[model samples]
Target: MAWGITKKITSAVKKSAKGKATTASASALMAQREEARRTLLKAKGTWSQYDGHLVRGRQFLADVVEQKKTAHTDGTHTQADGELVDIDAYSHAFDDTPNRYSASVLELFLVQKGLMENSQGETYRGPYHFNSATAVVTGNPAQSAAVQDMMEVLKNNEGAEGGSRNHASAMTIEDMRKVMAWSYKQCPDELISLIYSRVQSESALDMDNVILAQKHLVIRAFATTGFTIWTRNFELTKIRRKDIVWNCQGCPPYDIPYDLLQDHEYEIYPQQQTPEICMFTHLRAWVNFLEEVLLRRPLEPDEFIFARVGANSVVYASDQLSYDGVMKMLAWMCKEVGLTARYTTHCFRRGGARYRFMFTPLGQRWSLATIRWWGAWAEGESKNHRDALCPIPREGDKSFNGDHILTAPITAAETQELKMSFDHELNCLSGKVEEVLDKLTLAPASSTYSSPLPAPSQPPILVSSPQSLQPTLCHQATISPFLESASTPSMIPSPVPVDSTSSPSPPAFPTTRALPSSSRQHGTTAKKAAPIPGVGIPDLPRGPEAWRTAVKQWEDPAASIGGKALKDWPEEWYTGPMRTITGVKRNIRKVIAMEFYRLQRDEAIFVEAYPEATCGVKPLFDAVQRQREGRSEITRRATYITLSRPAVAGTTFPGPTRALAQLYLFIRRHSVLVH
Candidate 1:
């Protein structure tokens, strides 16, 4: 009976222990699920904030379309009509909405998905869509075709046709020039006031001038640096006059600052800074505009460069101008000028990049490395190594060495010269008009007096003025003393003096004059004359005497082609194969010249050593050509190997040195052939 009672108690104890464990496990599982739910809710809230802005952007676009339709029906939709709506409404909806996220979020979207951001954090904005359809209808026909072509490219849904809804349209040089010309003609005062405000503020305080100034600043920045609208609108701080270089710092990948609170925990990281040199002229303009017009004087290092200019000429210092403001200003300018091409803020960046790549000379071209750095492209390990090795934009460098791909900002000196030229041309035209009027006033009002004055004996000189100085829409010829200063001797041939007895003849068109084969300039030798076109290669030297001459020529610096220094030969001879030669210590040209001389002296010895060269002069020449083609590359590889070797004196030979040693041994083996 005691054993049965003990068995029952044991069973009850086992059940209680099992039930306690089960209850604990259920509670833990429920806690985990609740935590997951909270995390998901947080993420959803963040995304909802972003999605809310996008939805508002879509609604704004719809509203604009409706407004345009209404304007059309009322017959009030004209190009000059800037009063479509108040700027505040658009600004509030797109830029300053409470639901909007930070600028970094917009940048992230752009980088990851190719979705372009406007004042609002949305891809499709009103001005871009509206202007894309309507802007091209009113300008030049050729321009109209170009615009259509670009629009078609943007509109094409096929990936093979180089079209994408995500990609922005690019403007060509001709397109920019046309837009500038049209803008200048339509609103010269406004444009001038805008640029003028950069230097002199008191004269440019008018509301139109302030608005135009803001627009001009954006245009100049785009044309000069290919800055994205986000970078231009949000990233520019109160840049000092001395601060020519800009450094972007923030999150990895895109390098833009993000709000740590809203971002995922994993995404919150330290800032990484990357530096870019600003164009000199553009920097100058920006500094001046910021200090003089914006009145951001004694500029704080972190102060924003752009500000808001409100109605009644009120300037707001607290707020930064939104991407919407820039878009609206540009849209209004296009409409006012009747620009035929569709343009958006992104067009400037795309156009600038395309222009630099296509039109510039090889020496002035931006390498892939430079472009990647400037554009803040996706970084990799290889790119990081290359960036470390490159020596461009060295410290204390103040100017772009010689790059002219970016439209050079009009310097004060250049602007003054243009103005003077225009004045001189104007004076000449005025004088001619006055003379004609005087002649008419003096003549009798009779049929015989109607006869035209005897034509001038000499053909009138047609001076070519700078394009900037020329009158818009009207082409005219003028004679001015300023033309003498403007004309280059190489471009315009001196006029032959006409004899009094000789019949009048038409003026000769200017022809390019060939420079002398050898000349002195500024106490130095001038550049060498180019080889005559269509000329075949000259016969090379032969025998002992020829060998001596070749050696002497190689030793003499003046004998080098184009007077290039011995140290500069590697770069000068750089071809596709020569890129392998990273750092050559000696003169490669001299080495090649010496080899050529040795081969010329003993052909059989060279042929025996290098059997692939075969027999005859053709094969010999071919071998030399091959060596010349690869010499730079070989030298570079050799240098790299030498540098990489462990520090032990005379323990290892560089690749090029080793090759040279082998060649020496071969020549010694065939010494008997030389004698």
Candidate 2:
């Protein structure tokens, strides 16, 4: 019995030793894999991890080689080159070592803040790494006391948000509206014909610049597409060729025959047939451009889509589209469009999310659940985090359809008009103006489309006269300039959004849609009396003489053409993307109104003239407060009972859109109580 027991014990010891050896070998292999992964990630380069942690979770790829979405071993991250990276080591660089990081949470904050501060002073050459806390930069030790100090700092930041960088300002609906309008207004030539008219016209001789301009258009295409689909920059960078499911149902009937996307697999995520910034539309066009135009045909299954397109339109398939590269294009485009914010790639995620939640037409806006699923945010994630991303305005920021909730109180009757205005704006948000979009948005993309009262060449019933500019507002016979053009009800046309395909070429189109003409000093007007054939929202239609003056004004501002009345002034202003954008139209009108207000103020005729409109002693109360927030979105729905020829200044706003002439007066007189 004793001998049998000894034999069993010896066998168990041997088995245990073998199992321990196997475990040891497996751990060693994992370590080896981890080191290899880090080498690859470093070589490929990191942007989100370094760019102020712009995209969440990307910067946390230190402990795990490839950052995972959940607390699991199966990492979700992959390099742009489609390499798998799942290792339990931070071997990215010696600088990436967690020595300083583990010291305290403060170290992480210090790293980001330090890098941001440094990058601002010097031109950023590449992805920056956080250095260990040196004598120059100190870090509090990782202790309870240190953590408490950090909490205090966070509370202080929360308390003082005006000057705090604790939160990033997400793209508001107004910003999106303006940005999209600008994108479409600028990219029409490039989007449709794959060319930049303005750039080519300006730098026709400079082939290099022309090519670079074309390349920027391609970037614009990608930016617009990604924003519509709510895609992260990382996801966009690594979009596999296989995932490009092309559903070319309503694609422009391009007669140029090509196998477009021969054997491309289907993707269920990207929708089809939808008009507004359809992801499939952009992607299919990109693929078609590559296959038909550039002859970069037959995209491989594992290949990245946005590969670098070189000077000769050469598709460098080997080079993947990096985050930094996309950012450079975005930065240039943003500046060109006059966006003041320094938006990072995360803005796309934030912008789309906010648009869906706050800006999508009233009842049609996405619910919190849909937003969570669409944005890849966990259902149970911190409400604060989601709020930060899709910030709901509070106190002074609260607005609806560009009107302050308290100051510019919308009436029940005007509520439907406001809803319709948004519906129109959202319908043509992409500015496509295609048949599908036209059916969807109640607006046309083409120039031949109809608007009952065609956009005027200048503001009808012009109020200003360069000097004095004091105008009669409450006259019975001079109310023609405040009426919303028939079809527009206050909104204009749908703009055709911009697009590019990572290709270098030039696009031509001058995107300047300020309120033109009617200002006698520094403005020119178009001259056409036979009903201009483009979408416009003039207060009233202009006559032959008005049209003639506009034509002379536009053709020769110096009176070189002797104020000649030609058949038409020019089609560019009336037909460009700027005309479609509601914001641009509003902005131009705002400029004109502000100009009139300036002159009126100079003449000291504001309060004295607006006796009935002024709310008691607080002269021009609502105007100052209401215009303070969303002044551009001021409504033109104010009652202008008589739509007759002007008794004073001018007639049929063919010069400047006089749609807001009454609103300016209303601003001066109405003393709206804040809700």
Which candidate number maximizes lDDT?
A: 2
Residues 313-343, model 2: lDDT tens digits: 7676656788787788767767876887767
Model 2 scores a C-alpha lDDT of: 0.42
TM-score of 1: 0.29
- Model 1: lDDT equals 0.40
Model 1: clashing residue pairs? 136-340, 581-636, 582-636
Models 1 onward score TM values of: 0.29, 0.35
The clash count for each model shown is 3, 30
Summarize candidate 1's per-residue lDDT along 43-156 as a digit string, tens digits.
757767877868766465456546666656653443343545332233333444543323433444454434333333443422333256655333234345567788777556
**Cα lDDT, model 1, residue 128:** 34
Best by TM-score: 2
What do the candidate models score in CA lDDT, each in turn?
0.40, 0.42
